[model samples]
Target chain A: MAYSATVGSVRHVFPDLKTVLARASPMRSGDVLAGVAAGSEQERVAAQLALADVALRDFLAADFVPYEDDEVTRLIIDTHDAEAFAPVSHMTVGELRDWLLSYDADGTAIAALSPGLTPEMAAAVSKLMRNRDLIQVARRIRVMTAFRSTLGGEGVMSTRLQPNHPTDDPRGVVASIIDGLMYGCGDAVIGINPATDSPVATIALLQMIDEIRETYEIPTQSCVLSHVTTSITCMERGAPMDLVFQSIAGTQAANAGFGITLDLLAQAQEAALSLKRGTVGDDVMYFETGQGAALSAGAHFGMDLQTVETRAYAVARAFKPLLVNTVVGFLGPEYLYDGKQIHRAGLEDHFCGKLLGLPMGCDVCYTNHAEADQDDMDTLLTSLGAAGCTFFITVPGSDDVMLGYQSASYHDALYVREVLGTRPAPEFEAWMQRMGMVGVDGRVRELPVAQHPVGALAELREHAA
Target chain B: MSGAADDAGAGAGASAPASAASTEPTEPGLRVVDPWLELRRFTPARIGLGRAGDALATKDQLALRLAHAQARDAVHAALDVDAIRGALDGHEVLHVRSAAPDRATYLQRPDLGRVLAEGEAARLRSAAVPVEAKGGPAVGATSGFDLAFVLADGLSPVAVQEHAASVLRATVSALPGWSVAPVVVATQARVALGDPIGEAIGARFVVVLVGERPGLSAADSLGLYLTYEPRTGRRDSERNCISNVRPPVGLSYEAAGHKLATLLREGLRLGLTGVGLKDEGPSLGA
Candidate 1:
């Protein structure tokens, strides 16, 4: 409990992740090196596989069960003693909102309910009771604690740089990186989706992200959105394996689509952790899912896509992934076809994922062939931004050549920040200032001459001085 | 979507059996339209289902979920090859698996799903030409069979287990005396494996009946992929497809076979297949 802290209403761990670091025991990464140095070739090989299997099996189920105490749940229960808050219990939503505004204007009491209820849950439950509400609750949530590699040592809203490249085109990849970093993005992870399934092609993409990170000194993680097996291969082969990525569903068949088993997932976790990939401790995995994937995988077991999707959070949370996103409209209609459906599904996924205590984000997007337009994405983005979403996909001009769809763009992030008053992860915000992307007056600057290739070094240095 | 509706039913009113009128629109401020109910047609596609506030109505939600479950079941369902062969009683059969080791590997590594297991391929390759040639002209004299009907469980094995035999029966009936090779039943297969299987078996042309990815409402849907001078590495553009061979609602096996037979005849005559050749099965009145 000493490792935890409260920000507004939700409780979060101050989380140095000592337990995770300590558990890298029994098989210290050093043990493998030692065995290889001190044994026969076959013994060394056996030692390696044995350690790998243990690491995979060590995927702790405890992580998915919400490690922090549900303090907000207690607050929600306390409010149910209608006699305690009877003065406002019979009032209408708007009136209750206004009354709470006048009474607890700073919103401390109202913010306390946010971690307990997502927007949809709040909407459905607060119908009859005036005192019980999340419309008011949402307006007050200030601090959120989410893991994104080394980014969250405290509480904040964060966004990742999903600069997906078709065939890992370096120029296109670099352009999106430049655009995202300028707009104060990538506080979370700069994950990529590779065009080819080949493990070699995937490693090449991770190398690209690594080079960019080293050159710019960006304090974030990078990933090639390849399958987990490929990612594990990259880590083992000494490629930059910051976040191991995979697509997961609620059933065996869906999980099979990515060649994953419980043992495989655990192995992937152990593999990444063995490399000590995270500077912020064991938050190494990155998972993406769409609504109908469970059904698509033949593993829904009679549950709806939403419930099955929610169940996938258990898979995600198990490895303590730094980011878990729902690529909502990716599956197309017949599952969730139009913009309205996309918006509703996005909110539901975000709310459900957050309620289950994962760092939830939404890919506010539409395929060229889907029954959705940019306006639908607008609705989804704004709603999710207002509801404390953790991240959104931003590509160059919103067209992902690889995935062949349009998603939220860099400008959309600015729009959410401008309209909703949300800020990027604070460390990222500081970097934005240092690079002169956004200035003291809270207005974004043109990409500073200093940050451009054409800008003269002496001139830029004098300008800075 | 069906499951969502059931959830809505459970959430809005658990006791209502026949009518959802209790939770029906009382407030005139909004009206939720049941998209399908508004129309007077049958469609596998979901429509007209109105919203419960901003989400799907209870019935629509439950229906969607139900469709989803059925679709999942369709994909995960294994092809009952023995049952299929039994249904086509006394027919000689050849069983094969794609290079993919199992269902999981097949889904992830599709490249593996497009070829025959090496041993099976080699076995077919080594078999001598048929001793007897029957039906039509000798399509390929070097390899004595006119055709091989390869059955593959592509995305949904349910499609193969439920509909492939009936369709095969319809197909065989249509082509009365055509010299067909023993039917090749393949597991963990994709459409292109028809090429390797056909070439190995020494067939001049191949008709592959495989399962299509299950749609929300239509799970047991069968599809036919036709190829000429079949071999490995055939592009999708080079093959003609006769799809959605589900019972009752989709194309009947008789009709599907007619279309496939038409394509085979046309493709053989033209000495080519795929995009240039179109199915005039309807006009030809097979």
Candidate 2:
């Protein structure tokens, strides 16, 4: 479809024409004046007005046409009149240039009128006008001014925690990981565990790495934090050498603990500095830590559930001084040796309450194995929340495991309410009050009134007096 | 001839006795045609390959024909660099030489294809190197080109040959104000090499379209990788990717382009890349 071009210049129409000179002389109130007056301001004004009339007519008739099926044309046509046309004639060269440059008025009117105009069409029109050089430089300046008004900023940090087994499709695994990193559980962390380490699995992992690098533009380093294993090696070695070989080549597992810790530290420092430097006004730091290899008795890294909790608590305490925002808790090794229930019952409590300071938190790992029954999940969530957990990330039985995580997250929310007596408490103040009270140091403490009887309150007051 | 006819007649008469004595008619019919009795009547040469002599073909022949057809198609559809240049309106065409001398060589030598050609330095010098700001000189700027387009011959050349235009159109449509540089087609390239292309163009954002490895079900899938403030010496952690750009199994061009644009805009806004930007999601529709 053909569209009309919007021209902002009068010189393009009349190159030789300078400011118009009026031939008619102005009439005095008591005396009749006739003929053109030499250098009369009134005459000049009349001439300029006539020139402006011509320019306005030409603009309306030539430049302002229906660009799209929109209200802009109707508004322009309805608004166009002798009065509107005359104002342009009175404008000085500078004023005219400014008016032309400020395409925002015209553009906005057009946009308002043309509700059906697609973004592409709008872009095309904008491009065409800019290319024609008829666009007023003043409009450019206007845009520049308004651009600052729209200025807003955000920051993101992504990390991928590798899984224990080789997955069927590594690309899917990586996508899920990145998705988790972006919008999974609160704080945005993703975990992966492949079932085996066959060539197919390695290829899948590599493919996932490639996809993250290529499709998502995630830095290979941060996108994949570490590939983990619960056991250093499986003792059952037999005909399938690939599995054994994979276990032996567990490089990611070996390096995961240190790698993830260092990554978290670096990310935290970066986020903190970004906030400090005013580069990022808002900050959310995420970390994905797993204990897949910790499931095996022989593969213990001298840190059981309690030790992990204490270490996490220390880390959280250290980061608290820096005012880091958002910490995600991910649990791994639930499927190690086919979900044999290796960990103790109070495991989540130490980590969630004592360490992370989360009254309710999500677990990032779930596999379809022997131990992930509904009851087991309910018990785990309840104990974790009571001990201060808030979110649990569980995968579905379908091909896309992340969808399952979303489903499990809803169920987990319910479980938290049912078991821990903590509902979706948006107001932290109310939550703290419900819990009991806050100490002067911002720690949870018993309310003085609750702790003391009504008569004891008076006694305390009397003691203070 | 008379003796043969008489023997045939006597055999036919002997078969009737078997047919009459049997309780089951079907069993008697099979007994009458017993191979042991008929074994002396046939020769080995007449029994094998006699009914369908000319119809059968060997497996090797079928494989050979299939390979020939593939080779023919590959040659016919090989991208014409000249045609691409004409389409780009006098933009200098960059021919990235893979270390692999030929297609076979290219397959084995992925590293060779990742580097720019010898003449690229001079071409880059002659062309306007991306500047951070308009007044800035065309060389050695901190922020580079407003936009950069990188094309790679990933696992499948056919993918590049098929989807380049559509992907480019979608991308250009999404980015309204940015100045898009000419597309660079690289052979035998990997994903990590996009950093250099960004550096070469001095681009704020680098978008690479490459062929994805063909699966058993899909042979011509395309993939895209976009990075914000892509420059030389940037680590792999500073980029994001959009994979599976072909239809059915992956994102369509329009969707991928829109997402890429959103990512770039978000990255630029945040001054961060990789995992930081992954969660930002698309801002266009939202």
Candidate 1 lDDT for residue B72: 57
Q: Clashes per prediction?
A: 27, 56
lDDT of 2 by residue, B1-286 (tens): 0001000000000000111111212444453332212211211100011001111123322332343233224322345556555555545456554344555334323344455556663465446445544545332125555677766665556666767667777777887766666577665565545666666666767777776543222345577777776654565567676766776445787887787777767776677778777745667432
RMSD of 2: 36.6
Best by DockQ: 1
Q: Alpha-carbon error at A428 in model 1, in Å?
A: 1.3
Tell how far residue A228 is off in model 2, in angstroms: 5.6
Name the 10 consecutive residues with the lowest summed lDDT in model 2 chain A. A144-153
Q: Which candidate is the best by TM-score?
A: 1
